[model samples]
Target: MRDHGIAHIVETILDAPENMTAVNEIKERAWQAGFKAGYNECLTHVNPLFKSGFTDERSGFHGIDIEAVYAAAVDAYNNLSISAIEDIEKCLEAEDYVDRLRLLFDRPGEEDEAAGDAKNDAGTSGTKVD
Candidate 1:
């Protein structure tokens, strides 16, 4: 039947390896973009927090430990960056066409169910529910 042939063509196009690859590439690029955006946003807030200050002590006038401060700032930045990336990744995974396609092809395994449980435990979207 013509309808069957059309359905076959649609299925072929959807299941094509090249199409899957392209979709994966697009998802990766989107994730990278989200990471960059989150990093930049965090940087904007963190840059001003790193400042040198002078301290008056009984011994003598001394400047704040620049090295220590820098180290702490770097640690905070790294932590913040990681948190931001995770949040963004969660948001991406929660609602995306790439994940939809993946779910379509890949049957729900135990790991998948666990991940779904985790997602449910964390609430639906990345944004605050309240």
Candidate 2:
């Protein structure tokens, strides 16, 4: 099986399901970062999927399943060569960065105690997209 081109975009979109106003900007950041990391070819494949406004709805539009897509993308990403994995990791890391930015912006001047708990979780605070 081949890796779907929408890995990074799917990752970002899944993180901010409530606020989509910044969706395009978030996607752009993810793509540019992925491209620099040598995943532009991959992004090209995913570009068309998001162009038709499938995400205009909060349900991500009828029949659009992000969880499945993300799983396929990540599985495919992991099977790529070491260098490709590194590039994908860079894009994934960028996604993480942007997500943190969103959280920071939402909270503004206040800090939530759960934030501290999440950070201190000894269970590794594992990243599971599925």
Candidate 3:
């Protein structure tokens, strides 16, 4: 897909009420589980290793523990923007894949049919009657 189209999807999800609610629920759960602070601390420990591994990818990743990576992922979930996290939750709630995608483009801000029809009629003249 084009970049702008992906951006539009992001914008739509950010505006969706259901997406917002799901995101908020995640935040609340993270707070209750003490994952927020754990996530911050995990970032400090793992980010340097992750960056180095990314920079080299051949030799730098030799000793990084798999469990540490998993912990980082779980902790980092709380750091994601609610709208971003909603992408997964919303997809799960969708009836099907295509319908889920179509929801993103159904803009509430679209212009009304009458305004578009008027623009199309701009060059027309009134019809003469017998």
Candidate 4:
């Protein structure tokens, strides 16, 4: 995503509390805003393609569905990765993302065991994806 730069974060913290923790919090929020801004920019660029109704359901359903899933995955990944810790959030996000994919691809009545398996796997790894 687009990096709005540390300058903005610095300016923000400079006007706020002088505590280091507050500074860090401001920096984190700035990082998140920058990330979201970039994502929104992407969506703005792509919106025109879908707005014209040129894509019929039978022909474009799969592509549109996949794009939606990808957007959701990106949002989940962004939120999970905010702490920059590759240990906990990374694993949780992966498990949840996989579970969602399974839910989407599996037949309606076939998801019972797969979800259980995912939860068990994530639990054994020290994180509950549910």
Compose the digit string of candidate 3's lDDT tens values, residues 8-49.
677765766755665666555545345434544566677797
Q: Which has the better TM-score: candidate 2, or candidate 4?
A: 4
How does model 4 score by TM-score?
Answer: 0.25
lDDT of each: 0.43, 0.41, 0.49, 0.42
Candidate 1 local lDDT, 1-130, one digit each (tens): 1113235335655556655555565555555555555555665666677753322332221343434544554454344333323433554455452334333433334233322333325422222323
lDDT leader: 3
Please provide, for model 4 over 31-69, each residue's C-alpha lDDT reduced to its tens digit, 9 standing for 90 to 100.
555555555565666679677433233332323444444
Off by over 4 Å in 3: 1-3, 35-130
Give a tens-digit lDDT track for model 2, residues 1-130: 0022245345543454333423444454555444343433444555686664223233322354444544555555444344333444664565354334334233334443332244325322223343
Every model's TM-score: 0.35, 0.20, 0.27, 0.25
Task: Sort the predicted structures by lDDT, highest score first.
Answer: 3, 1, 4, 2
Q: With candidate 4 superimposed using the best TM-score fit, by how many Å does residue 91's alpha carbon deviate from the native?
A: 50
Candidate 3 vs candidate 4, lDDT winner: 3
Clashing residue pairs for model 2 = none
The candidate with the higher lDDT, 1 or 2, is 1
